[model samples]
Target chain A: MSIIIRGARLIDPGQQLDQVTDLHIKNGNIEAIGDLTGLNAASEINAKGMILSPSFVDILTYLRDLNQIQKGTIVSETQAAASAGFTQLCASPDTQPCSDAGSVISMVNNKVVSAGFCDLLPVAALTKELKGTQLSNMEALARAGCIGFSNASYDISDNNILLRCYEYAATFGLKVFVQAQDQQLGDGHMHAGATATRMGLDGIPVIAETLAISRHLLLMQHTGVSGHFNQLTSAKGVNLIRQAKAQGMNITADVGVAHLCFTDTAIDGYRSQYHVQPPLREETDRKALLAGIKDGTIDAICSAHQPHESAAKCAPFAATATGMAIYDMLIPLIQGLVDAGDLTWALAIQALSYNSAAIAVGKTPKLSVGEEANLTLIDTSHYWTLNSSSQLSHGTNQALANQNLKARVKLTVKRGLVSYQM
Target chain B: MHNLAELQLTKNGELRHFLTPEGLDRLMLERILDTADSFVVVGNQEVKKVPLLRGRTVVNLFFENSTRTRSTFELAAKRLSADVLTLDIKTSATSKGESLLDTLQNLRAMHSDMFVVRHGDSGAAHFIAEQVTPDVAIINAGDGRHAHPTQAMLDMLTIRRHKGKFEPLSVAIVGDILHSRVARDQIHALKTLGCTDIRLVGPNTLMPQGIDSMGATTHNNMESGIDGADVVIMLRLQTERMASAFLPSAGEYFRLYGLTTERLAQAKPDAIVMHPGPINRGIEIESAVADGPQSMILNQVGYGIALRMAVMSMAMSGQMQQRQAQALVSSSLKGEAQP
Candidate 1:
């Protein structure tokens, strides 16, 4: 419907729409974002003192594909992404029969072809089969419409493989996504320290992330390639990412919504659902990630969705499978940022929207008349958990069950169509 | 009496320090097993104290900890009517150069009779036994991974009671055969009892070199390694054991070496399963097999106490005289034996 959201607090980080003004939308495009109290359209969305900004974007998501345990193909995640207000996402190539080729990229892209819910992009594995031994066919994958190159497990045990990956992906002019974690240190489950101690559980120390990030940043500089560090956990890691950004390195980074929301302390008594790879870190590290998000060191927030069945998380902490929280973790997680006052409404919207759109389409979304209908219309006050029911992907692995969440999407519009309308 | 000073332990009323089962005699293991059998019922009793060591201090000066072993020792000592004191070396002054002898001297000053010793050095119990100047008793809880004498004795007791004899036994040890102190101790004890055929089986990464010196044939293949073995002793795989040597993945480890039903069938039809505890379910052995009808790992935990009682009583036998004398003097100071 042609509509004008009247007297709303429009926040356009690209245009610096921090001031309170009414936003006008017609034909599913942002027509004008001026003070229009008596603006005329088919419908007037009373967005007074509410955020009228572009929809959120999560650069990383572990979407489950059926035949290919690699990309985002699960029916559940697609619906949940729309509900959680993620319009665009990049799925890692780390699956069972990994996405290392153009065929695999085509496989994911084709499956998500009908997925008008969110803009799902396939992230092909940087190395062949995620063995960290050889580089995947970058040219072939790019032809298959793969947007990025990344090691799904991002396990760069051999420094030569890493250097070559950067060098090869650099040759393609395509950025690589790296879930960089040092293989040697930080081998434990939770974030190391008093939390792990109290839970009698082992933890991967924060130094592992910082060390891994530093190594990747150095590798990027060495190869002069663009790579994004997936899920920057520690403050030190944030500082390191910030340093790389300041050094004019073409390195972008993201954090999972869970990492932004929870701390390693959530692992008290071995709560399995809080268990994610490159795990939820310490409070200081969580704060650092928040600060990174706030200061733009962390470029985007992704829901590192991993839907494990019941038997997966039932074993002992060390023995259990590492991955949980797909459908119901994002909104509350972001809401937690707003609640704790670490995230501003404007900055969060920028990280969620234009920055992600910039990365996906390789440019920022402007307030001009003819912009593509890739927009998100969210009300500040809708609340519900779709995945918490039997339809939930939890299968009883919901870690943030009682956590308070606020702020939700009323409708997510992609290409001038209601991709996910609640 | 020649080695009376060395007798810091007593089992089945014998006087001797339980340093090595080799010179301690093959019959000593049987005697310990018998004494432990007598105390097994005591463990089940609500009033477990038998007054065998009442008013006596039993110090557990463990230099290395196996929570499974330490707990059993504590339970055994408490059941024997002794006041048990556990000293963990990791938290003590030994890390600061408090010599083992000096620590022993301090405990001796406190009138401790039995030293349930567990030291990281294999011969540490033997070292302490050699230096026991007077009537104190030494029960080797475990010393390094070299030997857990009581563990060996108890394991023997469990074997003899279950299988009736070691002479006709064919035992197999799987995983960590190289560095396991329990494997060494069990091997020696089994050898003393004339266990004719013993197989050492595990990946080359885990099997100790020169295991042929222990008179056990090393088998790289788990299928062939456990062939016709009467008892299977599965050791825990310590990831710490991995050096620069690249071991296979946990999945690979399980596939190649884990004691699944298929692998377990390689042993004798009636052979039982034994693990020293804290088993890695999928890595070294499967869950169904570990908790299966034939697994005695939990029983081994229970039998540890009886074996420890046998060793402690035997080691402390020589001290009975001095202890009785002190008791008489104290009673006399209380104006005659009141009863």
Candidate 2:
């Protein structure tokens, strides 16, 4: 298959390239770039006045496939990922019949391969059944096509066992994704503050993240493990990770887009859509997370796309399942970050594309010669409302529903295939 | 209108569900007090019954056990001539593991026109009000540390009947305001009724954070808080508060902050004392102060019935009006279809 995208503003953050140019693809690879006016192809996309960049890489997502297919499936949700301009989505291992063993990893990998919409890189559970009792067969899971190992927000009560798990993961060269949280202290459904107190809901304090992050950082230094802290929601957590990096610790961290956009005050009306794990914190924490993103202390910003059916979020705010369906709003939210001046387009692309891909896949998908054509064309200045009617995910719990977004995905191409088009 | 207060009203701002006092205005609150005033005369009469809610069915859905509050609400509904169904929900289908929604649905199927709810969870009453069948009135009896509007209104009535208007009153709410929904509702009601010099008297651990932001001055010392206050409201310290380590012991709490004769002397000479009853005597108040000449504590219980009668009748009236409006709209649509 051969195709050409013409007159698009190409941005390759990994290569530090941002310019309007024409690119040609053939046989699932970038054939040529610059002045492709004379080129003729079977399929030509008039990408005039569009920002064509490498497709995004989401470091955390819960497709909720397998036995928990009632929430979402690989087929339905991966397409939602495609529509969101994400060509590579690293799914969390928190599914039913979790991706702990090689068989489950293989099942997820095979399903992703068959779906063929986008790459669904499986993150195997760091512990067996994510119960934190014993370590899973990490070697076999890696061999079965798991990209990384994560406990997916499950707390390992035994720190000694957790350190051993880290040591073993380091030996196997598996990047460990730790969602730092003290489950015991994090009993509440929302951020601990005057807001939670006034709302009469239980509260999760900032120490829940900072204390856990501090412990993990210390363990990372001791065990010599490559730890990537997923969903750091507190300012203190960011400061701790920053300090760890300054001290030459092999660690990285990412914050969720919802954390970047909303705060605990968003749940003032008991709006359950904003009820996410590692709950949206206060304004100081939010400002710090954005500052971390801007200064490169935070390695990347991910969607942390947790999709849930309407019923899952229909209860009271505290009782409702935590997560927002953010797969189809990833690019738009990144654009919001850019428009707010907290991040430049370069930094946004680096976090959403290059940095995330590097942590998950060990390589960034850059648009260059002899590279696979995984690209997204976006209308970066368009405005649209993100209501239920406009959403493509099977999940209906959206924190930004009825919000006006200033950017949208126009087309997403994966391996030279037109995976999505608007 | 705050959350619960806003939820208690209809689109036209009429009282639909009297769930919280935080949203009711001075006029609406005065109307409730006035309505309760008329009921006081009825209570004093030979037959304490009215035909205001003659054929209406009022269901008391108490998820938590409450004998005193339940009886008063039952009496109020009975006085309004509404057929009352008092369900001991803790041991009913809810105890059998039926969800509150499912139980309410089953009860709604019984054709009850109103629900007077008392639950252990904050916002449980609001949840019921939001989920119940349309045109069904919901009166929050007492929810967990959130709001007990009827109790707050009765306190408002008790204060008004004793001391007159709230505009010039300096009220001090003492005790575990952190765990007392009555205190929360009273604070909002006091503020709405133009009571500006409101003071919350409790230790820092016993006070809810940001209570000062609600326009109430907070004080740790009891004497300073009650000094020059015209009304002193004592809140019952929940035993759970002690277990939660908010206080060391009931005895220790009584030693520091308990209302006694000496402490009551710190307030104005004309100041009256109030408590939503079933008080923990010696823990929250001394027996002498509770039984003193200025003690309107028992009067609060009497006003509680009148206040409940006011809320039940008002919510039923709002629901009836809403139903009539809906019927008119549907009939108008049918007429249009005929044309």
The candidate scoring highest on DockQ is: 2
Candidate 1 residue spans exceeding 4 A from truth: A19-24, A34-44, A68-73, A383-387, A390-396, A402-404, B1-339
Residue A120 Cα positional deviation in candidate 1, in Å, after optimal superposition: 2.3
lDDT of 2 by residue, A24-133 (tens): 98999999989987779998888888888888888888887888777788888888888888888888998888878877777887787788878877888999999998
What interface RMSD do all candidates show, one decimal each? 20.7, 3.6
Q: What is the DockQ for all candidates, taken in turn?
A: 0.02, 0.34
lDDT of 2 by residue, B225-324 (tens): 9998899999888888888788999999999899999989999999999999888988999999999998998888888899899888989998888878
State the C-alpha RMSD over the true interface residues for candidate 1, after superposing those residues.
Answer: 20.7
lDDT: worst 10-residue window of model 2 chain B = B90-99
Q: Quote the lDDT for A5 in model 1.
A: 64
Q: A249-348 in candidate 1: lDDT tens per residue?
A: 8878888777877877676434567777888877778888888887888888777777766556543355456776555656656666787788877777
Off by over 4 Å in 2: A340-342, A381-389, A400-406, B1-6, B91-98
For all candidates in order, state the fraction of native interface contacts they contain. Answer: 0.00, 0.14
Chain B TM (all candidates):
0.86, 0.95
